[model samples]
Target chain A: MKLTIQNLTYSINDTVIVSDVGLNIKKGEFVGLIGPNGCGKSTLLKNIYRVLSPDAGSIYLDETDIRTMKSKELARKMSVMIQENNVEFDMNVLDMVLLGRYAHKKMLGNMTPEDYEIARKALEEVGMAEYEERSFLSLSGGEKQRILIARVLAQQTDFIILDEPTNHLDIQYQFQIMDILKSQDATVFSSVHDLNIAGYYCDRIIVMKKGRIIHCGAPEEVLTSQIIDELYHIRSEIRENKYTGRKQVYYIPNSANISTCAVTENL
Target chain B: MAAAGFAAMIAAMLLGSVGIQPDWVVKILANHLSRHNIFSPEWEANKEAIIWTLRAPRVVMAYVTGAGLSLCGILMQALTKNSLADPYVLGISSGASSGAVAVICYGWFRFAGAYHIMFGATLGAILAIVIAMKVSSVSNKVTATQLVLAGIAVQAMFSAITNAILYSSTTTSDKLRSAMHWMVGSLASASWNTTVYVLIISLVCTVIIRLFHTELDVLMLGDDTASTLGINLRQVKIGVIVLCTALTGSIVSIGGVIGFVGLLVPHITRSIVGSAHKRLIPASVLTGGFFVVICDMLARILAAPEELPIGVITSFFGAPFFLFLIRKSRNSFGGKNG
Candidate 1:
């Protein structure tokens, strides 16, 4: 599924949050959205996922206007994984995942054997099949993320939108989740805080600042030290790691500049 | 649970101040069901009248009120995505109480006679819900927290008005007693007409709610996720609030403000049957009906000829039992800390 956003604008309380942002993501492309803390990445994604209506412009999934589509119809084509983690009611993993099939269900439809099969298969894909009956609230943060990923897999949409899916996980779990997402056949759009992880996985990166798209390109083209310094207001160097040959960012602390100057004489 | 509710209903009919044998109670019911005249001549006239005409309607009304209120609780909890939400959480009861009190104190709708109180209660409940919705919504989005706070504000305002009416009234003692009993909730005024009306409304609402069982489950995931899953959050919320208001208003109109039954029964049913609405709805209806019948029975028998208010009996027993259940399932009810 191809996603096209054209001049999308959103505002809250008459203050613009997302302003005239546009992008095109081809099918099966692993696209990453990167920006500073309040750069409207999440808001843009929310607009795409139909959580909030855009104040201006249009979004198209393939040739169809998204605004004209019904929620279930759109859900059948796209699935979203948001950062909200609160579960006010106690539900088990299987039950939670089974809810992903809601789009395919009738008003009072019963879950058939096929539905359970799909849910179990999704859990298996996320490597949480063993925890199907476990309470959702009892799971650790990483485990819960995996189960939520499993739920999106059960949704079985052609496109998936993830808002900081790896926000709070450890390195190993973060890589595990990214790896799983990287291997999926669907078109993936994700906003990631860690630039290194984004550099490692994204086929293309779109950078935003103040609700506008500043740059969009491959990792090596858009992740320059100058852009990073200006976007995040920090001094940084982008160096390729000898071990993995991926671009790694190293931030220079205020004192590190003095140390570098002191060592210059020896060099 | 359904069988227990049926048994409790029969027991309620049999154990009033004018006690009748279980056999005779069953025979009268059976005769009524079969439309036969066989047992009509043999049974004592007063016992038959007491069992069939009086206690039967009251017991049936108790069942209808319980089922309807519990179903409302489940819908409210799902709508707000809060386990603590009940039928009265949205200020319906307080609004109804205020209306009923105004009628009782000032003869506001004296021309309606028997239906004046029901009219006031239904109007008040609907008005309260509309105001709450209007106050809480911004940009056409109704959040659970905002809705709850709005309900609280509405409840406080309506309660103050009710108090003002109660304090300023110079009515006779009889009217005061009636108003007080109604506020505390009682089945003393149950009649066949009210019973039939409550039963029909409850049955229709339950069936309609059952159809949206899956939607209710999706709603618990919150608005964003529900919308992403193909649910129109706004439409579902409006539909649920309207249906819940109708069910709750009807219950309040017929049976005053019965507290705790709606709050306690759904939580108990959720724990036993898990959170699937398909099972939860039926289980709640049965358990709620059983609970109210048993509590009404205790209210009748505990004080004998002078019946206790059913609300007092429920709150007294319900509060302790709910505490115990929460203790037992500490992790389930432990919110975010769990």
Candidate 2:
């Protein structure tokens, strides 16, 4: 249940994208990774998921080395949901979700009714059960991302990794997706693009800058104004939300004059 | 679909230059299958001979060639993750053609005798695709546009080799003429021997591909996602490539370079059955069979005894469809949002 990374480094053409990173994620922890664009958050996740091998160091799920196990065995424990934009082919939503059961099936296995039941429930969890019969390509961007999340849910792994799960979603959808991920029982490790979203849902935040981990702790400790300025070089006002009781941030542009210091307070 | 395939087969056999009776076609098939003369020969000896020997093997070849080419299309599309990929578009067909032509002109693989063309065709197909794939790939993956462009390059080169061998054979004989017929893709030389060989290969390939239906489905999700989903990426890809190349080689050996069936049939069936290979593969196989048989029948009856090459008939239909698909795909890909 514990995922450990020891001294991991990954490089492409000798230009390191993930460098000497180390961490341990305990069972059932909601961990968020935050970094500026191209700061190697995705690359670090890829290394953890075995999509890319590190030039040094190793990862273990509990006592087991991930490198020694077959991909099927690894998939049984860890599921990954990277941004899936272009499918290029049309298929029924249910069938697409059912692909998550691939690691569990035998070579000549058929899609049993039980499998369909699991897929249906997963879709329902994402509020996409009614769209199961629809062509996957016909769905909107938010709907497609939901279906992909449903696919990950159907995978039924105890641990999951998501890379920028809501990069382009509208604010309405951004909260809905975060709500769904938070509601899950799995140990969730994700790269989060929106700082406010991460602050609201994530139990702990890991901040990366220039291919290295700069800070890691509770969101309140890690997402401070100083760290935000240091990481992205932007001025930001931070406060605890009165409603949700979590940290919330509002940015201050140098050109814009602030009438009041508290942007959220007025609302 | 099965009924349609049976109907198409009957029509293909009955509508040839020799007007054979429908009853005779069935009885002839029965006799061949049972390996006994179950029905008395009420028809002329020529009619029975035409049904059992000439037309039966030709019609079977038509179906096998159709099914095999379509399967290759599905595999290529899956392999490159591009809808436009096929044996013809990827230059695998032209590679097989060049190999087959070399065998015919120089009587190469004389040691292997009857099955030499298939081996040569397979070897040529492997070589052409290796070169095409090597050229098309950027980093570790092949993009849709680069694959098609590389395919065109491979196609042009292999076609040149085939033509060069055809033109440079100093002796003028039936061997050269038969090679010419095959070069353009005709079932005129299809016999019981080659038909059995190709039929076996098609059936085996179909079964193998069927086993990977789930893997192929995952593959459509993209390479990175599929592997994380537990698909042994290397194993599935190698399996698909080997099966596609072998089937393409055998198909060329029998039917020469029949184009567009491989490109057109899978797309058509995908539209009807959706993109899951479990449904799409079987549907494409049957639909492809029906398509080729109808086309073969047309090749026979189109200009009477002077048979047009089956490729000529298929390209007449397939070329327009390919252009239409290009425009359609381009439209979807044109905007940043598509």
Candidate 3:
């Protein structure tokens, strides 16, 4: 499915949070949305997922305008793993995952054997199959994030939008979650903070600054020292690691900057 | 299950009051159905009066009120997503009491008959709900705390009104006794007509609620989640509230303010069946009916001729159980972390 976000503008009161942002995600591609804090990555993603309506322009899932689609129907196509979900009630983990099947099931319809099978497979994919009977609130943060990913997998959507899915996860879990998304061959659009993880996982990257797309291209093209400095106002260096033969990027603290150093060579 | 409940209530009808034998009770029921005044029988005269006029209606009323309150409790709990919520949490019962107090004090009885009592009670309940809704809707999201606080405020206001009228009336003693009888909660006035009325409303409302149990389950997860799942939050919330208030109004009209049944039964049902409303709801209705019947039976047997208030019986049973359930829920939810 092609996901196209067209010329979107969003504002809260008079403050423009996301301005004239757009992206075209082809079928089965892994894309990252990276930006500094307060640059409206979450706001832009929220608009695409229909959590926040854009002040202007539109999102299209292929030819279907997302704003016109029923929320349930849209949910069936694009599942989301957002930050900040807390449950005050205790629900069994399996039951929580089963709730993902809700959009597919009719209001009064009982879950079929197939639905249970799909949920079980999704749980197994996240290696949380054995935790099905455990209380959802008992899981650690990383375990909970995995369970949430499993739930979205059960949602059976070809497109997944994750807003900071690795927010509180340890390094191992961060990779594990990204790996699961990578293996799924699903169209994965994520807002990521850790630049290294974004470098390793994303096929293409979109960089935003103050609600506008500052750069958009393959990870290597967009992860330039100049664009990084412009977006974050920090001096940085991007280089290829000789031993690993992978792109390596690191930042230098402000106190270490030299007056004679070139912008790209300072790190 | 409905059959079992009906059968249990029938069995309860045999166990209480002055010496109406099981065979005689059955004959009275049958013969009464055949259009004869069972009171005309050559059987024991005192027994006939006791069976016909007193015990039977009381039992029926107890059952009706019990089922109605429990059903409303379950619905309101689901609606508000607060376990502490009940039909009275909207101050409807206090409003009903205020209206009933007015009728009893003003001697509107001669003109109003039962209509004045039922109408006044219903009007009071409706007014209380309107106020609760008003207070909560000042902000778009109605938090559990807001609803409870509004309920407390309205309840206090209505209680003051009831008290003011009680103190000033020349007929204070008589009105106070009747109001106390209503407040303490009773099935003392149950008759065939009243039983029929309670049955129709409770049954219809219960069925209607059961049909929407799935929607109720979705709504309990909070509005944003429910809306994402394709259920319109505003319409469903209003509709359920109206339905619950209607059932509550009916119960208050007949039985006055029976406390804790609504608050207690849903939690009990949740523990038994988990939080799935499809199972919890019907289970709540049956369990609620059974609880009221048992409590009513106990009320009849414990004090015999004097007749204890059904509310007294429920609170007696429900209060300690409430404390225990709260403790258990606190443990299950792992204390304040949520």
Candidate 4:
């Protein structure tokens, strides 16, 4: 399904963190949001996922205004995976994944065999099917993230949102995560930090600075050396990847390190 | 666990200040329940009064309070999303006692007749929760240390309120003594009347909480995950708060502030049953009942003929356990702590 937002503004303690941002992702497109640290990319994703309500704006999933939907109803349409927060308790891995079927089950309903099958298939997709009975807290960070993706997959929504899904993973695991996300048949919006990864996976890249959407277009069009310098303030080279012929950004952190964004913002 | 609780209750009835024969204890209970002598009374006449008239209801009160406290602990843990959360540790019981004292000191809420203390205690429980949560939740997340410290603050504040009411308003020594029961927690005054009321309230709350076993499990994954997984976060949290207050209110009105049963029983049971609430709830309730009954039995015989407050017994076990838990889980959530 298509996703839309209009005039979404979110602030904290009278300071605007996300200011009057508007954007959309057409059906089945993989859209990546990229920006400097603390640019409110995560916050904007939160607004769309209903974790943080926008201060003065609207988000729509297709024709439906998100505000009009029940939390459960909204969850059925779009699933979200944020940075892993520590859990105080541990459950079996399969049970954690089966949490996705909650919206499909009644309040007093029992999980049917079909629910287990869905969870198992999602686990298989994430290469976690063998770890189904292991303690959730026992997994390594990257493995835990994969299991989380399993949960998202089990949710089976056509729309998905991820907030920095590969923040602390090693290079190979990071690409593996991006690969898994790209392979899903869903309208995906994710906050991504690696410019090369974004260029490789995203159909469109939305650039943000100071909580506002500054640019949006096909990755090849948007990842110009000028725009990279514009958004990040550091020097970077944009060139075609040898294998894929896609736009790739190679960072030269030492070159032209200066800000022209006209704001003294926290990074 | 249920059978163990039953056995412990019977053992408690047999072991009080006076040891009534186990055979007579059974006969006394059977006769009382069927409203006739189920078996011929072959024991001393006063033993019947000791087993049926007095000890039976008292053990039942201990059973209910123990189970109630355990349920409150489970609910509070889920509510705060912190395992360390419990009614007594979080000062909910003290707040409840403050309400019970206010009612006792001035005979407030007399319009509600027999249920006045329950209402007052319920309000007090709610106020305590609000204060504790308000202080503990400076960050959106309530960590183990923050929750415990906030509970201590709320506990101290409400304890002072209870004492202030007891000191200022009580004109007679009798009022002071009865209100003291509400402070330290005792089943000494538990009769069929108060026992029945507490049992019913605790049962209702327990049933309601048990129904949310799945929701509680989901909530452990934290608020954002829980909400996205079809939990109406506000509604579930409110339901937990309301029921916990009601349960704490009634138990405090009748038995005073029983400390740590909620915290101790749930932890021990969780270790055995794992974290699934379907198994945890029933097992913890039964274990809580047995734990308290045993504790009360010790409270009775250890000071034979002069009973210790049930809180003294539970705190003896709970306070150190609480400290140990803190030391163990100090680094469980690390961003907030050094």
Task: Give per-residue CA lDDT, model 1, range B96-161, as digits (tens).
Answer: 777777776678887877767766776677777777768766554444556557878987887777
Q: Which model scores highest in DockQ?
A: 2
Angstrom error at residue B90, model 1: 2.9
- Cα lDDT tens digits, model 2, A1-267, are 779999999999989899999999999999999999999999999988888889999999989989998978888889999987656889999999999988878777887888899999999999998999999999988988899899889889999999988889888888888889899999999999999999989989999999999999999898887999998887788888999999999787766665435544664
Question: What C-alpha lDDT do the candidate models reach, one value each?
Answer: 0.83, 0.88, 0.76, 0.86
Identify the leading candidate in terms of TM-score.
2
Interface RMSDs of all predictions? 1.8, 1.7, 3.0, 1.5
Instruction: Name the lDDT value of residue B226 in candidate 3.
Output: 60
Clash totals for all candidate models: 0, 0, 1, 0
Instruction: Report chain B TM per candidate.
Output: 0.85, 0.94, 0.83, 0.95
DockQ of each: 0.62, 0.71, 0.26, 0.56
* Candidate scoring better on lDDT of 1 and 2: 2
lDDT of 3 by residue, A1-267 (tens): 879988999999989999998889999989999999999998898788776789998899988998788767887888888753534445577776777787788755777888899889999999999999887768999988888888889888888989988987899999999999899968999999988788888889999999999888888898878888888877777878676565778777688755426655544
The RMSD of every model to the true structure, in order and in angstroms, is 3.7, 2.2, 5.1, 4.0
- Which ten-residue region of model 3 chain B has the weakest summed lDDT? B329-338
Best candidate, lDDT-wise? 2
Q: What lDDT score goes with residue A29 in model 4?
A: 98
Q: After superposition, how far is residue A142 of candidate 2 from its true place, in Å?
A: 1.1
